[model samples]
Target: MADSKERLASSLLELKKYQEQNNTGVVRGSSTLGRTHLQRLVENGWLEPVMKGWYIPSSPEDVGTTSVWYANYWNFIVEYCNSRYGDDWSLTAEESLTIHSGNMVVPTQIVIRSTKATNNVVELKYGHSLLEISTSPASEVAFDPIYGIRLYGIAEALMFSSPNYFKSDPVNARANLASLENSAQIIRLASVNGNSSRVGRIIGALKNIGRDNIADEVLKFMQRLGYDIRVEDPFDNIVKVSASQSPYVSRIRLLWEKMRGQILSMNLNLSRIDLKDKDSVLRSMETNYVKDAYHSLSIEGYRVTESLIERVRSGAWNPDAEDTDRRNALAARGYYQAFMRLQKSMATCLEGDKFDLESELNEWHYELFDPCVQAGIISPADLIGYRTMQVYIKGSKHTPLPVNAVNSSIGALCEMIEEEKDGFIKAVLGHFFFVYIHPYMDGNGRTARFLMNMLLCSSGYSWIVVPVERRNEYMQSL
Candidate 1:
């Protein structure tokens, strides 16, 4: 008879083969032999039970991990959907938009669509839930071959989703729509009409492009059918007209006016200070630098003090000191380390041929954390955890970006900053984008502030620190 170890090894090999093929529903028998095998697999940390009778391959990293439930979620959902629904399962329009935006901030309740009825809210482990809603008769769905699932078209997606989804914080909603990098998708959305009343509202919500004509045409067609269409353009402060008032005409007209206003007000000029002389420029630069440092630290959730600033200025700051001043010392050291790294990054950028901002920023990040990582002040694992902890707040919803995407977004942002000519705009955008990307496991806000100062320094501007009092405004600006 085979020993327990031999049996365990055999069970592991079978499980691995199943996982490799992306098969999740294959049942191991419920006999004594099967129960023993599964128990051994779980005990040995080779498998994790996702739900009843379902198992996922587990790595050493997966044991006792609570933070990255979304990663595990994506894995389980992909497996579960494939096993149960095959190609019949699909994400809702809003979920599709979230995916299309390269946003990994998983929704609290993932909305999906299927031919079969499911519970409106299905709770998952780790405080996440999935809401599966049936698509309306007027809704249109299309197959996304990439994921082998059907999803609502952009036009259908906008129309079918709640108006509250677009109306909350109109600026961000408009920004998200405007920043859509895919032109073909936009055109496709513009071409579809009469699918949903929400399409008219979506057209009104879009910021850039002269697609009002298309929307107008669609609205005219919808109005001919006597649908009670009301366009909700949140960006405009116009009078709310009744739907009885030419709904199509009023909505499209207001959207066009708003679009024109946005186009006219799109300021590309970088803010500049009037310096009387080189000395004045130098003084202003210093002031801005200090301001930037203070604000950056404040935003990063630090309580800055004069002593900490002094230590940072002096170069004798230490994070591992065990005195009463340790916290302050650590803050000071972290600030200085970030500052020096920024200096080195800027210098490297100045010397480089390709103007590679992303590469330089990444190099700076490594340099900034090297000392802490080496001295055991913070471990490599913690550093990784810090980067993964970045959360993006959309209205009241907080979405955490996956670790892998954070790195990519950071690199992309650096490339964008390198292309910008306006120093103030560069600084502001860099700071916003860095925090938005949340690249590192931790220290992202500090790193971002350092980046802001570096950009300001390059252009002969002062460091601008945000005070703790203005934290709300700081986050709002971002």
Candidate 2:
């Protein structure tokens, strides 16, 4: 029999091997992982069971982590469905439209369709469940894979989606419809399915979004084929938001609209924005810099101090002689530099909101990393923009949008803020959504807090310094 130390060594080696092969730490219980191995992991606090047969890896220190469910939600579905039904399964029409609209939030109740599905709900952790409905879908499906889960193509999804989708997620529905780009696809599907009612709904949706050309083409084609059609506007209100037809724009708009309500009330103590009080504004910003920098850097896991911040601010920053000093000093310097730029931007927004925002936001990212570049810690090529690859939060299950979606999300966010007159909403949503988007690889938290403060400054509110000690509270609120 193996001794305790030998057994532990064997377990550790096996765990490493499993994680390496899978790439994701998630493990199926029966494959290379036995009940003893799993129980050992549970004892060590390195694993959490999502369902009876599924387990997700976690850090021993990270006890009670449920976001693991959200993080791996779709991946688990893909694996589960594929194992059970091969390629004979896909997301239901409504769920497919949800993904197309860029709402990646994990649903509490997920619905899938498969020819070999069990047609029953399998309960998972946190009250979420997988409801798979068996359906005899044709072998050939116009489908796409998002984060591994297969779904109907945008056009097919839009073509088959219920009117309830238009009511609940109109922006998403319209965005998916806009992804169709042409009436030919819809016309073809309508002809093949021979569903005049669904085709009429699609035509109405196209017309509602001002796609007169496609709607007219589709209408004429159906008329030519001797089919009587009536367009159906699903929403009670005929009004449409002035949104670009680009799917990215529509998705971003939809997500922001759905998410904004949660964070709008986070800061309600601020007075009305008085950007005219320039001296008062500047003084408030200056007074808060040391505390702000200390808390912000510390929250980001930087070992920064008041002394270090002052040293960097006082032009006494010389960290080249020592390696650790160099890294910490660079962090302090970057914070100070970015803070100064933020002050200037706040002042400009006070006078007018007409600055080149894209360029300015890019400059903010560049300023934060320029210090790191100078210290030879990061590549200078990335000095001008957001991360071009995926990023995951350290401890949270919430994943950021895909890297490619960052630009459009930021653009839509800025446009929303620019058009709104409410300083409070701007501060709250701007801060929450910026970090939620996680646009930048390194400086997202610092930048988000800076934005929140700047928008607060517009309302004559004092800077709300989130202390390092309250980092847990800050992140949880996010």
Candidate 3:
């Protein structure tokens, strides 16, 4: 019995060593990682099953267990898709552009067009699924070597994408369309495939986005091919999308533009205050802390009461002091710490100073989770950086961007916040984009609300405490 236990521990150590040596989170089930060992590792929380035969490494102390999912979404998909279809599969046009634009949010259903596909759905954990469409791609469909997967060529994708793509992801959609140096490739496809409808849709998208020359050229070339083409604007309206050559920048621009309208329509009854009214605002924050902590913690599903928060704030919190649930108590403590830091951050933002706001938010995220680290609920590394895996919001269809998108999105977000003239937009959108990105493994919502209030303070609005009861409405509004 003793020898068996020792051998299992040895296997665990070897697994960790192998992961470090390979510098990869992916662990495939094999002879060494047998069913018994895999089940044992999962039971101990050191490995999480990404799919039936795959797993990603985990920290035993990490309470928020979705780290592996966010960190390895693409890797798992690429691998799983290959195993299922060999080389006969291609990702859909929209998803390819989503990746191209650095918006790697785990889509609820990844659309894979493949010749050998079963046309079935592969259900994954956390409401994510793989949707296989059995369609034979044209012979001209080319794949990029860098993306490590097969997809339709830029021109083919643009020609085949749904019209709804223009409104939902106009920046990426337009950027991709504008990126094709010439319509020669698409025209060749039209000539070869004799697909007039696809050519017409492409022309409409191009013309709608102000690419009249390309649209006209495509029209002429397709006509020269002796095909009568009918074209209509794919999108409802012709939106002048602003974008530079950088696809990442364009993605950020599109996301901001899309959400800004909703922010304007939000509860605008909150009166604006003077930024110089520091003392008055500080006093109000002092009064609002207890109420804010309770709701904030409650919204996060922490069973914390105002009384418990008051106790924690008053230096009466002792995780080891009683039969109290230490986890909840520590969470309250962390929230108080984060709340205080936010007050200081608000002061700085209002004082007309320029500091690296990114690091400042990093500090806030670290503060929010510091107690969890100390309580041995999560490792110290979880607070040190952004999430590594895909995350899905409960009951929400929107999937956040991949880890690759986090830094660029935040950079663009910070730039927008500083340049915007409307404080309302800055405050509301700042909060919206932060959580939309979901950069951290946990505490994203709480941290976002704090940052929102900081932006609001800059514009002279009081802290808005969303009661726990309205969590559903709040999420739905978002």
Candidate 4:
């Protein structure tokens, strides 16, 4: 066993050096590493095979989780495409628009256009595949230099995107459309082809999202070009229009407007709990603590127990005195502390008073991770604010918003929560959107549950416990 571990460690060191030299997760089978090293790494689950000769860095712990694959998906595409076709390929218009809008959710299948493609599909792990369509690369291709995936420029992507695309994914379409800083690109492209029908839909889509001035510019430009156009809105429905030019904010507001109605229509009973019964509520919450902490912590992949939770709550678990078990105890202690803080905030809401919701949430996040910081398990900087890098959820296709989009999106979501009158709606959408944005690097699931229960408590709803047994369904529903 010692010999095997030493061999595995040596192989991992080699792989790490290769990753550092190449500065990528992707590893080609034909590279300098001999077959023996590749076989050992694969056996130990350190490298995941993408195809016959392609692999990406992974770990044994990530065996069942698709997060590794999703995280490295773009890197594989960039490496594979660059190897096969050099600089001759670009993503299809629809995919380009999706990226341009800052929605990095991994698609089940991505279509690529290239002068050298053979019009075939390259199957990837987790049922994701790449379809290559043979076509002359567009002159207006753009590149995301960081990922090295070529894409259609924003204006070109919007112009060439199918009419059905606007209706099929109005959220991304609306976002990218709103991202057009002015009408110059649209006017320049529309005037070249005299595409009256496409122009008409673009004009209506612009007006649909409350960009009427740009819409008018395109409209007048087309008319002056001696083209008769009948304007038509492509979207089947229009959500609330945000004045902010940010696509991420626009997407959040649109989703909130669209989903809040459904949440309200669920017809949940949200009567206020009488302040006289605050003691009863507190006792009930105390009664539910062990079960709640167990499931919430367990669902987040923490190995915790009811006894550990009880010990932490009763001050029997001390970080300073329990060095041998302190690593395992961090999550329990942090959760207990954060939950207590949450209950106090919830008590304030129970009094029907306004509080700084943002500050309250930040405290919840801080309390949840502060124990880890104190234990030297993670840097204290991690708890400072929202995540500074992209985060992929386990077994989920939904990629959280990029770091650049985190701040504004959170602000927009908080404003919506404050403006909302119904507690149940706030609870439902607040929980949904919080995880949707996935602002934090870790503890998002726990924090989201806290936010949900906080709103629920404010409206007299009993504390809802999501069971670990329903973990799969819980993730899918989110």
Per-model TM against the reference? 0.53, 0.83, 0.69, 0.92
Writing each residue's lDDT as its tens digit, candidate 2 over 1-478 gives: 9997687667667888888987656677665677777777767766777777777766676667665566667777777777678888888888887776666777889887887887899898778888888885433455433466677777778777887888887877877766676788888877777778887888888888667788889888988888898889775555344445456667656556655655464644544535577878888899999999999989988887899899999989896858777778888898888888987887787777677666677777777777888878788897657788877776565677777778877888888877767767777778887887888877889888888888778666767899899889989888
Residue 452, model 3, lDDT: 84
Candidate 3 segments exceeding 4 Å error:
1-83, 98-111, 117-134, 138-150, 153-155, 162-172, 178-233, 244-249, 263-270, 274-276, 319-325, 370-385, 388-398
1 or 2, greater by TM-score: 2
Where does model 1 exceed 4 Å of error? Answer: 1-12, 23-37, 60-62, 134-150, 169-176, 179-196, 207-359, 362-432, 435-453, 456-478
What is the TM-score (0 to 1) of candidate 1? Answer: 0.53
Pairs that clash in candidate 4: none
Per-model lDDT: 0.55, 0.76, 0.76, 0.84
Clashes of each: 18, 2, 7, 0
| lDDT for 316 (candidate 4) | 88
Full-model lDDT, candidate 2: 0.76
Q: Across residues 1-478, which tens digit of lDDT does each residue of candidate 3 receive? A: 5586686696697787777885555677755467677777777777877677787766577534555576566667776777678877878877777666655555777888888988888888787888888887534556543236576777777776777886777767876765566668678877877878878888888887677877899899888878899997777767654434456656666667777876676756767776677888877888999998999888988888888898989989887744456878998999999988887877776677776678888988888878778878789887787888766675454567656667777787888888888887888888988888888878999989888877777688778899999998998877
lDDT of 1: 0.55
| Most accurate candidate by lDDT | 4
Ranking the candidates on TM-score from highest down gives: 4, 2, 3, 1
Candidate 1 weakest ten by summed lDDT = 241-250
lDDT of 1 at 45: 68
